[model samples]
Target chain A: MLSPEGREQIKYKARKFIFGSKDTEGVGKLAAVYLLLISIGFVYLYPVLYMISKSFMNLNDLLDTSINWIPSQMYLENYKQAFQSMDYWKTFRDSVVIAGIPTLINVVICAIVGYGFARYDFKGKKLCIGLLLFSFILPPQATMMPTYVFYTDIGLINSIKAFIVPAILGQGLKSQIFILIFFNFFRQIPKVLIEAAKIDGAGHFKIFRRIALPSAAPAILVVFLFSIVWYWNESYLTQLYVVGAFTSNAGGYHWSSLIVSLKNFENSYNTARSVAGSGMVDINESIEMAGTMLSILPLLIMYLVLQKQFVESVDRTGITGE
Target chain B: MKNGRKTKPGQLERRENAIGYLFILPWLIGILVLVLWPMVQSFGYSLNKIRLLPQGMAKLYVGFENYSQIFLKDPDFIMGLESYLLETLIAVPVIVAFSLIIAMLLNQKISCRGIFRMIFFLPIIIASGPVMQQLADQEAASIPMMNVTMIEQLLDEYLPHVLAVSITSVFSNMITLLWYSGVQILIFLAALQKIDTSLYEAAKMDGGSKWECFWKITLPTVKPMILLNVVYTVIFMSNNEQNALIVLIYDTMLSATGGYGYASAMAWLYSVIESAIVIFFAVLIMGRKDVYERRARKYQRELKREKRLEKKIRKRGERNERNYAKQKAKQQRKGANKKSA
Candidate 1:
């Protein structure tokens, strides 16, 4: 039989071997978690990677089933076709104008409205809040036609004003959410600060501009980014209002704007093929992918550049009511 | 003094109310002109048979004819409504549970946490309808590396047909669903951060296991956020253009024969059904009265005990004061008698 010291030494050696004296179990757990996260991340990123890869592939490479992940040859022709067909420069400008103006308007107006809701007590405040929530719950589709008609009657159709007008009025797409975010944010600002400003004889507007706006920078940024994205991706409203407005300048066909081009391309392809004597035309997936990539390229770049701010903004905006 | 305090604050409150109205005036106008007016007109449109002409529009009072047609004649409407509801019923719980789990994982003190958050949130930025459509067309929503057919076959053999189909659909579109959960996860993570760490520490010191801690502490604390997430998911998923009801409404609006009245009727019906679903879930999750009632009862008991204690102290003080006065009087009388003798 071994002495007590000898047995202790053996046990210590076994412990050292199993745990490496640095908590090998924790390392193992972390490794498993990271592995899971990385795989899920890859799954999240697959479509984007696929889009990027397939956008550069030629027709032959696209049709070749053996080829995956990377194209046999880098093809510039797809992008060239996409750019020409999409009226790339003009539509990009239009997209900026269409999405940018509304974002700016929504940020300012929503902040004001949210501040009002947050800081003030008034008659029928609950009723107003209930109405705001009701508006949010009511789908835009429920009122789309009437609004379309209203805009048409007012000669606002086929123009950016159709979008800008509502935005100016603080009723743009998901503006209620922005308002709520700002409301939540402004509510969290200590009342004592505002009271001090009041005692100093600062006007309400001055206090808001100086104190509230500066402090709610993160929420404002979040709302701005979200508004830009929503407006950029807004096909339904654009389709309802301005479908064929600029077709005369672009070509005999409708102007192939970024998002609308995807749908239009299929229709144009079908018609062209039918006119040229082919009854069955397989939709070209590669060109479609290329167009989609171009559409989201600006957004992806924006995300990459503002990634830190975007992530931090989620915490600061208090959307989860923390 | 009371009147002075009340009047001073009341004047300030009135002034503040005016400022508040001034700030919200634009939104109020927007609600009236853009939202409420449009809604009222939509109801009117649904009630009429609208005819478009070169110079003007004509409207004839149809009186619920459009609604009847939707229920009785339109197979597409029925099918779309059914599928939309079923999808929502399955998707809401799955989304809430999935996002909560992801949020918990992301909340862990892990390396490269910011990177993981960015990767998850990237989807919200680029998940436009066209891009999603392209992915769906390419079958990219499914896992490319796994053989789903074998799993589907196994599920089919073991489960009922409807159950198998729903499960398989969820499995195939698992990545897409995960993408949809990006914003939700962020919301949940924010809520999770609000949970005080001391509560967990206390639980652990009391020898509570991790699972018990989650049930007793985490779940209750995050219950309100869970309801918020459910509401958000329902509204978002149903509003999506990919939803069958929205698609049906869009198609009806564009159809040459359907006209504005029929489309309006369809939209109104869809909204009603959507509202019904929302109310049902709200009541199911938020209607429980036990937690609230218990808290109220506790508050009442505490208030009653405080009042009782206050009364007892006041009575004792009053009795002591009276006895001291009587003893002083008795001493004065004894002094007067001694002096006279």
Candidate 2:
């Protein structure tokens, strides 16, 4: 019933809505973006998903080639075995302490040092700053042996002090990066703000505490989270320094972390398997996946809870622009 | 640094400097004792054959024997170093490039961007060495649907063998490599978000296509960030506990055959190589100036050149006048001599 001209106009409008015009985004582009993001996002989360699904599959389901993702049934035995083998409660306690105390010290010390570099001029500030960045590139492996010896000499080899001492001294895990982040962040604080505070007869420490530190919530949060994560993830150093993996220094000190236990899970599980009777099932992929899941479970929960803040922190962190 | 002038230190300036030092005193001492002193001690350790006594370490100096042993004698280190270098060379670029692409994509006007970002960044919270190892063992590090072998074969047909092998290795563990780029994506996103929307509009007004604007504007603005990401990627790849060389060093440190001395030497060598990689990337990316910076420099140079030309012309005119005066004086003197004659 429509005229030919009216039909053509309607067709053109529909095409424009889909294909887009010069000044507006079309549905086509949006669809393409979503498609790309969705595919890549799937690839990104594929490992975690695979880990989760595999952890629930029983031996029969895992051996079946027909089963790709979905398991025949939920299996909680993997978690139970992994829990016992890892000594979950004890190792979890150790991980918390090992990652917690140093993170706190690192945040405080790095902030103070970063603030000093940002706001002050000293005789050798440039040299100090250069060294600060240079340290980031210098591998911790380069200093591992001597540092181990030094810790041994100072009676910190097999204790939590091994981690805390370096942290208190502003040399914790990735502390250089944290300091740089703080430096970049605090630099953006207008000079006038500090000047205004100073004119009120406040001391330098008072000014930093009351003025500069208060507005730095975003950087502090980012550093705190990053520090905790890095410390928690660090198993090699933890074993070498605090856990006394070599057994020579394990006389009075008994420290183990969750990640370290996961790393040595096979050996520990074998040991546990021998101690238990032959009734115990042989270790399989499901149980191994379950152990991996348990190790990362805490961090995954933390991320889920604090994700909004964590994602937004990068924007205000000025990590790239500076 | 103020106004590019060096002012004399007043009493207040000196006092402020002291206060600044006080604020940073903990870090300064920390670096000196924990970092610098250990560095010196490690170098000393590398020169010796150390024995771990129950009470203390006994040292017998061996000069560069440990170094020579690493270069000439140790086969495990050489092979590990080769594979490490090969994998890292392939991995860093792939990670950084993927991160930049994702950053640009996320920068676009999209729905549920927060969820997408969280998905991308979830690995950072969980990707410890042990966890990664476990996932890798379960064959979870690769996409189930991806025919990695097809890609490997495709690469082999086109690329050199060693290169193809490393690329295939990268493909095999592609998810882990991609996971490593979470912070990098955040960094690039921050930079991309800071870019003014008005600039893109201006480019559009100038008849620039989206591709051209991306190449000409977006890239140039984020050039510094590329270098930052490269350096970060290099450091992360080298220092990650998953690295075989680090594990090798740790094992060497504890092994009965190779004592702390040999391990120290190996670590120093590895650290040197690591620093070289970082420097190489830094120089490769940092060598070029920004497009805007180059243009500004060109304008400044042109202005300086014009002033220099004006000054040269003025000087030439004055010199010509002086010559002319001298010639006129000479002619006048010649005429006076003729009159005297």
Candidate 3:
């Protein structure tokens, strides 16, 4: 319906529209955006940076009111204090036993369960998944009281079993299901490749162990990170079951339960202050800050390192793109 | 139906199924003992109120009394639920919007993009454990150290409790929530990177402004992702203990007004409400393909026309300016020669 001249005009118009004013006017806009972005970056980063700086300051420097961004001196006492005061090794060991065992179980349990859901068709398979998810949606807090009673009756209370049992059963893996991603990825596996493996008389287990698991490695890794982070960070259930575990020890040496120890430190800091003094001491502020600093360092390091796998998984899962 | 009957599971299939079940025994055993059984036992506990050893050994099955007490008698249940929902609704949108904008900026091929991303992503890593403790401590310390008493005096003199309660808490808690945006930011970055750059080029060809490109091309491409973000945000926000669900649960569980049964009812009720909100919004946005198509088409046409006109004008102006400059230079040269002679 259009003439050559008209078509050419249209093409020219389109080209100008897209690439037009992008260089000059766009620079001002981009600069403003960058300024906004940098400000936000500063806001997001300041708290963690402040904590890291504070961690290096001694008890006295931390208590100072001037709030200098840099310390007057590089005080390593806080780090030493955190290590000695919290029984770092015992807590770290306990964290490993409580957080690690479950993470391992989650990876293995989820792999088999996720693989089965992905590659198989059987009776009640759909029902099992639906029910599993239903259980997942129910808040852990609601389930906690009942689980406590159940575990107490079974004599699994106050032990690592209480934590790992749920993880082993895939109960605690709720947050890391990656159900849709797994389903879509499994479906996309070339039917021919699977069939060829089958024709060679390979059992489903062999095929899964050799082929499916390796292929789902990226997704598995994503799930692995998700499960580990979740299990490591859990406090509510851990606090409920492990309250007794801490009362047996004193003087913050029971750092194996970091969450509980942090709470204890907060309580102690608040109680230690003399409210009736001519100048009331507020050392609680610095001690609280110290506890926080000590608590987050490992997680920060872990996240900074594994951010690559996290991003790559995001791409593979189409979480961002489509 | 045909496939179902024709490929009925045989002995090999049965064996494979057995092996599959065996492989998944870890979860099966765990779920049976730890989760399902506990849940069932919880249900039993919920129907009957069990006073601890301190309160004397008496288990009374009050039927639906606990649920009724929570719904009718307990004043905090309704208020707690309402406030929690309201807070979640407020936070989800705010965080999602904030994250989307940041993700877009971070996705650009700018300087220190990876570092910037790290800055944003760092929050998620430290969202739990010591980081949370530190953040909460700082927030608590700020209440007294920052001397909010001055502002509190001002508020007491003027603003009502509703504003004081909602606005003050929201403002005070915001510093801590800045960290919460990390997950959504990562997701948005991932979504932004997936968008084909050629779409922007095409929009450029049509004479679309940056604003127009965002609306016509960028927004639509990322619609599904927006939904995903919303879902994740709602779920996370609802589950956050800081949102007062923890406090409410603790208060109820500690008091005689509510217990395990009541908590379960409240949780189920809250979940339903959350799911409904998610579904409602999802349907509202994705319900109309025609609306999206129309907007895209209108934007493309408008852009194309303006781009053409602007191009023609700019070209002519540039040509005229160049000619004028050339003439002025020639006249100056002539005048210099005449003066020299």
Interface RMSD, per-candidate values to 1 decimal: 1.8, 1.1, 3.4
Which candidate wins on lDDT?
Answer: 2
Q: What TM-score does model 3 achieve against the real structure?
A: 0.77
- lDDT digits (tens) for residues B178-200 of candidate 1: 88887788788888888899888
RMSD of each: 7.1, 4.3, 18.3
Among the numbered candidates, top DockQ falls to: 2
lDDT of 1 at A220: 92
lDDT of 3 by residue, B1-341 (tens): 65654545586667566665665566566667666676666666667776656553357888876667767886776787777766666667777888888888887767877778777777666676445656665653122234455656667668776555554555456545567887777777777777788988887887888888887777888788787777777766666655576657755655565655666555545656766777766786677454478878899999999999999999999999999999988999999999998
lDDT of 2 at B223: 88
How would you encode candidate 2's per-residue C-alpha lDDT over A79-103 as one tens digit per residue? 9999988889999998999999999
Scored against the true structure, residue A48 in model 3 reaches a CA lDDT of 68
Q: What's the TM-score of candidate 2 when only chain A is evaluated?
A: 0.93
Every candidate's chain B TM-score: 0.80, 0.89, 0.66
Per model, the share of native interface contacts recovered reads 0.73, 0.88, 0.52
Q: Please give the ranking of all candidate structures by lDDT, highest first, separated by commas.
A: 2, 1, 3
lDDT score for residue A72 of model 1 = 86
Off by over 4 Å in 2: A1-19, A248-253, B1-9, B297-341
